[model samples]
Each structure stands twice: as structure tokens, then as C-alpha cells.
Target chain A: MKVKVRVVPDGRHLEVEAGVKALDLLKLAGMNSESGVVLVNGRPVTEDYRIREGDEVTVVRVLSGG
Target chain B: MAKCSICGGPAVAYIRYQRRYLCDRHFVEYVESKIRRAISRYKMIRQGYRVLVPVSGGKDSATVLTALSKLSREFGFEVVALHIDLGIGDYSVKSKEASIKAANKLGVPLIVVSVKEITGYTIPELARKARRPVCSVCGLVKRYIINLVAVELGADAVALGHNADDLAVYSMKSFITQDLSNISKLGPKTESIKGLAVGRIRPLYEVYEKESYLYALLTETPFLHEECPNVDFSSMENRLKVHINSLEEEKPGVKITMLRNMAKRIRDYPKPQLPISRCRHCGLLSSGDECSFCRLTKRITGQPLGPRAREVVRSLVASLQLAPRQDSAYKS
Candidate 1:
């Protein structure tokens, strides 16, 4: 979807075409659903959500803090 | 005017007892001397660096700030105050307020970060899903957040509010788990990733809990006296403190002294290493592909990505499995 993927780590980014769901696209780009956090333009997106062109995304390793 | 306790030098007044007129300045000098001795003995802080003191606005942290501030002035180093609010309602409020008060009182800059604002989940909600050992998660978060913030804000070291009793229980926990490597990381001084962000240091490593509390009381530093709600008194340290409190009627000072010594001994004879595997996904250090914490959180939030926290919400999944249990005799 021509998205800028920032893993808090830039090396984890991958550019792909639209039509792929955001979750699947992230998974394909080595984002582990178990420990990964997905934030599209600073807001979190659920798994079922899809990706569109030009989305600025940040994916983090889910740190469950008390 | 009071006579000196030890060297019998010029003294202002008797400090707590006879032959102990250490004087106000002398008392500070004495504490500072002990702190300096420990720093030199342990090689705690390096030259030309900023130390980040994690002040929770609690008595421990406020007293730590006051002492360290004095150290900074005398020892000619710098210090920064850091506060993290786990979003625990009024308790967290008290902590934050207390921290601000300390910062104002000490005239040090304080940084406050909230879990809800930074992460999207309050500590309690996250705790419900993340569950026990979330304390460690909180600790890790504190580390990561502080390091990240410190690096961004240009700090070099990080000090925590951990007391002697906390240290004792921590050492005991390590012994129980037989995790020598984790024990190794529990040193008075440990450097963080150089390229990653800031180096971390703990000035209060030698300071006792009771001493900290006493300092807070004597200094009148505004600090929260209550414990975090997440910490049940079931902790070994708490239990031990309670038992000791009943028997000896002494303040928390003894616990602090014993634990500090234990950690010092352990640090002196360092020989422990635990394997660290990075989380392939985030590149952060972890013991598994998905850390247990991450797995449980995902599972609780319907992700079921982890093993056990992934147990399905069967009540909704299979209506028949849930409908009949409320009243055994009135099963549908």
C-alpha cells in the first residue's frame, strides 16, 4: 500500500502494494502477531483492518507493562 | 553547643544521642561519605555524565533525590529526575504529585510519562491481561521507557527507587529460581547499550529503606507513603518486613542494611550468566520468540497468540459449556 513502515526500528520496514490487509502485510514483513504492536500514523489498528496507500505506520514489540 | 561524637571536633548539637553531635553538616557529610565510598568501591558512576533518578514521588525516591542532589553539588556530577506513572488512579496521582513537589523542592527538572498516554493501556487493564509477574513487565517498561526518554533528552545514567528490602527479596527470588545470570544483572552499576541510548546507575544502592524514609521525614520531602496497589503484601520482602516489624519494632533500616550487604557480597563475587535471546520481531532482548508477557497480552485481547493466555473465551465460544453452571440444580 506504499506505506512507510517504522518498527521503532527502521530496518523492519517493507513497501508493498495496496489490497493486502495491514495485519497480513505486517506478518509478511516479519511482524510477529504475538509480540508486535501496530500503529498507523500514531494510532493503533486492529488485526482485521486493511492497509491503504500512503499510510505512515509504526509497529512495536508489544510490551505488556503493569 | 554539643560535643563531637567521634573526633570531638566543633559540633552544634547532639545528634539523636550522647557523644554523637555529628552536626547537620556533619550528618550530611557522613551520609555523603558512605555514598562516595560505595560509589568508589563499586565504580558506580563514570565521569562527565548525567544520572537519571527515577523518582516516583514516593519517600524512597524523594529522599534519594535529596541525597543525590547533595552528592551532585559536592561530587560535581549532574542528575536528572524521571517519573513514570503507570496510570493507577489516585495512587498514581499521589505519586506524580509527590514527585513534582520533590522536583520543585530540589529545583531539579522532572519528566513524567504515563503508560496510558504512551502505550494506550492503563497499568491495571494491562495487568488484568498480562497478569502476575507483570511487576517484571513494569520494571522492563520502566527500563525501556526511561532509557528511550533519557536518550532522547540526553541523560547518561538511570537510578531506580528500589530499597534494601526490595533488593533482599529480589536476591532471594533469584536464589529460589536459581537464575544466576539475572542475578549478575542486579549489580550496583551496569552499563546500558552504548549506541542504544543512556548508561544507567543506581546511587541509592547503598542507601537503606529506613534511612531513606528517615531522610524523607527529616527533610520533609513530599513523597507518597503508600505502596503501589499492584504489589500485594504477599511478597516475601513485605511478609518479612511485616514479621520483622512485629518482632523488632525497628524501622525498615535493618532490612535495608542486610539486603544491601547481600547484594554487595553477591556483586563482589560475580559469576553468573543467563542466556539472552532477542525477540526476532522487535530486536529487543527476550527469552523467546514472543516474550511470555507479549504472548499473554495478545491472548487476553482475543489474539490467543500465546500458549495458555490463549485459552479461548469458551463461555461465548460454546454456549452449551457456559449455560448450566450458575445454579447446579437449575441446569438448562
Candidate 2:
């Protein structure tokens, strides 16, 4: 069930297990902040993105700015 | 070490097909390569003066710091690192850390200033109150704080990490505004008013942002790289830069040279008309009854900010700037 996962933040690459929620991938990527959004190919996705094989996930550290 | 072409000193870097040599202690030749000019080309440093550099822990500032540090030794000026912590979540924290690391690498004294300490409010609080854009508020606050602190430190000039990209934006805006005097004030060097104390300079004015980024990667500073979520990169300013940058391949130095020339022309021409008076409220330099910053600060402070806020909405509607929703005009 290992799927190719390129986590953002530290950009640590991982072979996370399949069906892993996006939030888990975020934590696995070594990111710990109040809020960091994620995107798959330029579209914002919630923490529940189902892990498929070969996903280019981009984690964005959202600054609570005006 | 490559021997100096003239003095037979050791040289490690090459420039413009010139086999230059500079000794370890007498390093003017090496400094010139980093600064892209001979020592005489720029008024980089004066006798026994100290410079405060506003570093963002980004590649641009890192390159500026390195270049200035090397050049300062030859030019005989003291260099100090200045960082403004915007409290932009992790970005600010990482930036401050990188700045500290850069300061350590360069062996210069560093001063840290934060909104929380100076202004009694963090960036989030300010942004929340005004509903103004984050970048605008943060940028103005940072610049104001740096200048004020630099002056307080008795620094001759405040150096910034602004690169060619930022300069190009200013040039374009100046051209659009047709404000010649404003352009004149924005050369490679800008001095504050006589009583203002600290001037502003961009020693890395000729350096490109991409080059800075690459240098950071090569230098291996522990930096957290992330763009501010607030700025919509698709905005007009960014889009124009990208478009003009794309055309740079067709004609080399098209955008830069043009901007450089425009800057020179403005420098050579008449000064822009100064705004009437300083704002009554905060008393920073201002062009109107209430500066744009003060107005924004009021809203950010959770005040009604009534009449001016309405004017903002009317102006937005009139200029077709931001959207003009009826009830939303006074929400701020």
C-alpha cells in the first residue's frame, strides 16, 4: 500500500501507505504549524485528500495575514 | 590563490576575462567582483561610518550581507545586521533564524526588532483590524520600523535587500504615475532629509533575485522558504513583471536597462512635487491630512474609521479598484 508521496514543508519524500489522509501526510512531511494549506496541481484541497500513487502534493505554510 | 594582476596578491575569483589577484588581507579586487564594480564606482561607504542592513533571512539579503561585508572591509565601514520580525507565523521565525545564521557567518553585530515590541501589536492584529492587505501593512511597517531604528542607532544609511525585480516594479509605477520627482528619489542611493539621520541604499541594486536565491542554495544557509499567502501573485504588478521578464530573452537587459535609464532620467530631471504636510496623527513623513498608513492603522485598530473608510469605498467604486459592495464599505 506504499504510495509515492512528496510532502511539502521540509519537502521530505515518503512512500506513505495508501488511503492516508492529507493531514497525516502533512505531519509526516515534518511540518508542525497552526495552519498550513495544501494544493495538488494549483488547487486547494482539504486535509482529507485520499492518497493515490504518484501524487505531487504541495504544502503551503499559510500566514495569518490580512 | 590567483595572484593579483597588479600587486601580485592572491586571487580566487575571475571576472570579465581579467586574471585578477587579490591578497587575503588586501581584498579590494575580490570585493569588486561581488559588488560588480571597482571601488570608485559606488559611494558605498564613507570614512568610519556604520551601516544598518534590513535583512529578511532570504537569499537576496544574504547575498547583500555577504557582498557588503566583503566590500565594507576594503571600503572601511562598519556593517550591522537589522531584522524586523513581522510575526508572519513560521515564515518570520525561520527568517529571523536564517538572519541570525547569516550574521554569524559574516561575523557582524545584529539587531532584532519586532512589531510586538515596538508597535504593541503583531502583524495579525494589525491586518485583522484594517481588513487591509497583509503585504501592504507589513511592508510599510517593516520599512518604517527599520528606518526609525537605523536612525536611532546612528547608522549613516540603511541598506535593503531589494533586487532588480523590485526596482523594475518601481520604475514601471513611476512611468505610469508620470511622477518624475518620485523617480528621482529612487536611485541606487537615497538619503533621508537632513534631520532624518539615516539614508537608504541598495548596495546589491545590480544583483538579480534569482542570483541571490542560487547563492543562498550554494551557501547553504538554514532558511525556511515560503511565499507570503497574502500577496496574490496574479496581481497586476507581478503579472507585468512576469510578462516583461519573459520578453527579456528577445532583447537582453530590456526591462532593467530601461528602468535604469528611466531612473537616471528622473535623477537628472526635476524633483517630484512633495506632498503638503505631515499627518497630524502618527507624525511620520506624510503627503496628506492623514497618511494612507494611518488610515489603515485606524481600521486595523478596530476603530470605526468612518468617513475615510467610506471615501475608500467610493474611490474603489469610482476607479473600479476593489469591489464595491454596499454594506461591506463600512464593515471596516
Most lDDT-accurate candidate: 2
| Deviating ranges (above 4 Å) for candidate 1 | A1-66, B1-26, B131-137, B197-199, B242-332
**Which parts of model 2 have CA positions greater than 4 angstroms off?**
A1-66, B1-42, B177-181, B268-270, B275-332
Pairs with steric clashes in candidate 2: B2-B11, B3-B21, B4-B21, B10-B22, B129-B299, B129-B300, B130-B300, B181-B271, B181-B272
| Model 2 lDDT per residue over B149-245, tens place | 5544556777777666667666676667786566676667775554333567776565544434434444554444655546575665665565555
Q: Write the per-residue lDDT of candidate 1 for residues A1-66, one digit (tens) a residue.
A: 266666643345666666566557656755433334455655444444566776776665421111
How do the residues A1-66 of candidate 2 rate in per-residue lDDT, one tens digit apiece?
Answer: 677655443356667777777667666664322234445544434454666655566664432111
TM-score, candidate 2, first chain: 0.58
Count of backbone collisions in candidate 1: 3
If chain B of candidate 2 is superposed on the true chain B, what is its TM-score? 0.73
- Against the true two-chain complex, what DockQ does each candidate achieve? 0.01, 0.03
Instruction: Give the per-residue lDDT digits (tens) of candidate 1, residues B58-118.
Output: 7667766887787787666667777888888888888898898988898876767666654
